[model samples]
Target: MENYMMSGEGEKNSSDVVYLCDEVFDFSTVSSAFFILIFILSVTGNVLLLFVLAIYEDLKNITNLFILNLACSDLVFTVTLPFWAAYYLHHWIFGDFTCKFMTAAYFVGLYSSVILLTAMTVDRFITVVLHNWWSSPVRRRRYAMAACAAAWVISIAASVSDAIKVEVETSWNNLSTCEAPSDGPDIKLGYYLQVSLLFFLPFVIIVFCYSAILKTVLQATNRKRYRTVVVVLCIVAAFFICWGPYNVLLFVMSMYDPRGCNEIERLYIAHSICRILAFFHCCMNPVLYLLSQKLRTHLLQLLHCKCVRIKCKERGTATTVIQNVAFIAQNSAVTLDPHSK
Candidate 1:
């Protein structure tokens, strides 16, 4: 009995001694710089998208409503990144509240993003495949708003779980780390489920939906086929390329943690790289959405109108030249009028 007790104590001591990687990269430099860049780009892009969707009366479609929510989610998520960047630099300097909030924001953004993407795909599918029943303007607007609300509720619940489970730990080196307890079985299970449901399942759905959409588009003979297919493919492919590795790496890390794994350093490095790729997703959506030909043309027309007004401030002569150029272009066969006649 004494021998067994002694062995148990020894095992406990071994487990209590936290092991950290020897060659952990000084990620502060790169992480800070990279996240700052992402924050600027994501905030600027998503906010501009939101503004465009809001102010542009012509863009007041159900699809734009969903996109507005998506941009809002991305904006909220990007706002939390600076905290993470600060953590990476100063080692989780924020208190427990911030830790919870920031972590929750991250997961919320993730869950919301996937849910919205899935919702968007389903919406498109219904509109395209069941146009008779699903394409009504009133019904589409109602459904899209409902879907957006449901996504927010689901994402909030998902993020709340993380807020509940996460705890801040201080290392011997005086660095505070936000993490779950080392032997937290419930937390581990929750983590696994969160990743699986929020990322893996949604990814499968997206792939399946996009594949079917592609097939359907190919079978049809619409003049808009090339543009529509390219846009959809770009969106789907960007999501897969940016987020896929992060999800895979997260699963691998979760698996390896419960079971003793070798080459910890390599896994850690891979995780860091995956995280960087994941961050790119926040900014990529705006570019994909805005770069669509329709949106670009609208933006250009707005800009040109604004430029014409601003140019009027320069001088009357320049204004007359501009008007004459416009008139001659409108009546291409006629020469520019020298006088009012």
Candidate 2:
């Protein structure tokens, strides 16, 4: 809040120096384009996945509950991307109120995703590693739903806490920017908290879960279940790969303050890129990618069946017409006879 200045940076006293405005702002267009594309793909992909999950009766299992919630989280995140693209293209026009709301929702999406993924991992751990003893305590779907509900609640709380720190600068080139508060300590603390809970902790837990699962698989030489195990493990690994760089960069920024204008600019560019990469993760979940394959197969089968049905209907109609015409002709010939034959 204290950092933004358009024409009066030089007038400020030396102790209050903060925030460097971009001289060119040239990256905004490119960033906007990339973000728009991400938004489109995320929305399109997640919506179809959600539809498939909703319709497919057999997929309504505990594991799929988490996957469904993940898709929901992605949709929520995708909704915010367009706003952000608009913000980058033209400064925040929606005012501070919408800014706070958008920022909160944006973080809610992210935090919920991480929380859900962790929940999924822990559920898998229990199912695979401790299946006989662990799951007896609770019903799987009910428990998974409860966990997802708790995640949503926790995510809302976290987002609101972070949203309080958002501030609006109104006159940045006659536009407003809703950004994190410019308090150094607060920014550092936010970064630390985010990196720890959202990335590091989740990453560690997933790794631990998978390690145990892998050990379990190694001991029992059932090659039949190995493929499913491997696929789930790869999904978890991809989650980390997608989000790791962004969190690492965020940590680095928290630890190292940008000193000079050039350093600041470079860091700014890097941060922008990392933010895009991080946001793009909402669209690239492992579960969704796996589900996409199944969905594609199902859709193709449905289309093929539909085509067959259409052909069958066409043939049936033609046969019915021919039969009716033959009956009419026979009746006409019968009627044309002077005497009954």
Please write out the lDDT profile of model 1 over residues 1-341, one tens digit for every residue. 00001010112223335344334444456766888899999998887777667666354476677678888888878988898778767777888888888878887887898898888877776665555776468878888888999999999998887777677778677778665453457766766777788888887887777677777777878837446446555666787798899777766655553212234445555666777888888999889986577777656565577787776766777788999999879776454555435
By TM-score, how accurate is candidate 2? 0.81
Q: What is the TM-score of each candidate against the true structure?
A: 0.82, 0.81
Candidate 2 Cα misplacement greater than 4 A, ranges: 1-25, 135-138, 226-228, 259-261, 286-288, 291-293, 301-309, 315-341
Measured with C-alpha atoms, the lDDT of residue 186 in candidate 2 is 64
Worst 10 residues of 1 by lDDT: 1-10
Clash totals for all models, in order? 0, 0
Return the clash pairs for model 2, or none. none
Best by TM-score: 1
Q: After superposition, how far is residue 123 of candidate 1 from its true place, in Å?
A: 0.9
Write one digit per residue (lDDT tens) for candidate 2, span 135-179.
Answer: 554477778889999999999998897678777777636867788
Q: Where does candidate 1 clash, by residue pair? A: none
Query: With candidate 2 superimposed using the best TM-score fit, by how many Å does residue 137's alpha carbon deviate from the native?
Result: 9.4
